[model samples]
Target: MHKALRLTALAGLFMAAIAQAATPIDVYRDPNCGCCKSWIKYLEANGFSVNDHVEPNMSALKQRLGVAPRLASCHTAVIGGQFVEGHVPVAQIRDLEKHPELAGIAVPGMPAGSPGMQTGQVHQAYQVIGLTRDGADRVLASYPADSSL
Candidate 1:
């Protein structure tokens, strides 16, 4: 009886953990962009839930979000209070969560090797940039171009 009770308690704790996890991120993307879909798939594969919206005016949205012209990407997401732009890797996303000091992160442009943008050929090296609401930018992570995967 004691062993069964302990197992039940453990299961309850596990369920509670899952229940307390973060909710689906609010995503804004153009309906006609396939790569944005791919990026969403990448997030889903990494255990993220996305509340997707087919944004009609991406340019205005990006501008309002303070995404600099040079740091442009295909999609935008809101997780917690921080923004995620482009095809940022799952690891970088988790890191951003860990460091709440950052206002947001971005992968900038559509790189060939990014999770959803992979074409199965050559991969392009890219940087995941951290951005502030005021337009400051810094490199959060750098991925070297490789096709080994």
Candidate 2:
């Protein structure tokens, strides 16, 4: 009976982990922005489930989400209660999930070669900026000028 009970508990934990993995990331972006769509595809290709929302007033949404104007980008995404701004890479997004201390992360502007913003081999250097709960901004990751990823 104890063995059966343990098996059941383990099955339940596995199911919970699967559910967490399937959690869809909610993304808000302007309908007219092609780069936003590209970013969505990029997320999907990277195995993330996305719930896309075409927000009419993105400025208000960004302000409400504690994303400062300085971190502005073409689109915004929310996952695990943290905002992801711009074309941040998948690796950084995964890192953000591990750090609850960060309110959100951003790649200021639409830099070429970052995820969906990729322009062939034209990879420009960029940094992933993190916003703390107390409203402090910090550099989380940096991609060098010649970086292909």
Candidate 3:
């Protein structure tokens, strides 16, 4: 009986952890941009709960958010205290969610082969950038351009 009780308690703890592990995102983007909406939908499909805000001045928003010009994109997302820019992959977002110590991850620009911007036969190599609060950026990972995927 004690063993069963302990197992039940452990399972309850695991469930609570999973329930609290979900990432909440706040996205800022152009009001009429379809790609940004599609990206948000992709995030939603990947288990993120998004709060979206449409803004006319995405450039100003980026500036205010401290996103470097080189890392700028069509939309910006704040997730788990990190800033996610552009059409970053859902896996990368999940990585950021798992590692809360990093500042954020960004895709810089809209690469042709990104998740939401997949083209029929056009693909471009791109890097996901990890940013620091002091404006330092590092390449987190490089994803090959795979439009054929």
Candidate 4:
């Protein structure tokens, strides 16, 4: 009976850990930016619990959060202690959550076919950039064509 109880407790603990693994995103953007609003909506649609914060100076907010220029975008977000820039796909965010060692993920400038920025059938190859606090950056993932979704 004791062994059975222990096994149940372990199972409960594992379930709790899975629940806690969902990514929590805090998005900072300019109040007047329509694209930023769309980005938040995109995140919500993709399973991230987004906490939106509108700021007068998004540039300052980005700087405060240590976002690099190469990763700059219309808005910024922090998730699990990592910065997320621009219209980053939710899949990449999930990938980041799985790999906790990554400093951050970014989509750089808004591409025409990116999540919230999707317009027409035009598609472009883009990179999800990973960056350190000191501004060191690298390509975390590359998406090609309009079918990247």
Best by lDDT: 2
Score candidate 4 by TM-score against the native: 0.76
Clashing pairs in 4: none
- Candidate 4 regions exceeding 4 Å error are 1-22, 147-149
lDDT of each: 0.85, 0.90, 0.83, 0.82
Backbone clashes per model, in order?
Answer: 0, 0, 0, 0
The TM-score leader among the candidates is 2
Q: Model 4, residue 120: displacement in angstroms?
A: 2.1
lDDT of 4 by residue, 1-149 (tens): 99999999999999888657645789988888888888888887766678889888988888887777767989888988888889888878877876665668889898878888876777888889887556577787788876645
**Candidate 1 lDDT by residue in tens digits, 10-102:** 999998887567457888999999999988888877778778999999999888877777888889888877888999888888777776767
Error of 2 at 32 (Å): 0.3
Q: Looking at model 1, which ten-residue stretch has the lowest summed lDDT?
A: 18-27
Candidate 4 local lDDT, residue 122: 78
Report the poorest 10 consecutive residues by lDDT, candidate 4.
15-24
Candidate 3 versus truth, CA RMSD in Å, comes to: 5.2
TM-score for every candidate vs. truth? 0.81, 0.82, 0.77, 0.76
Query: TM-score ranking from best to worst?
Result: 2, 1, 3, 4
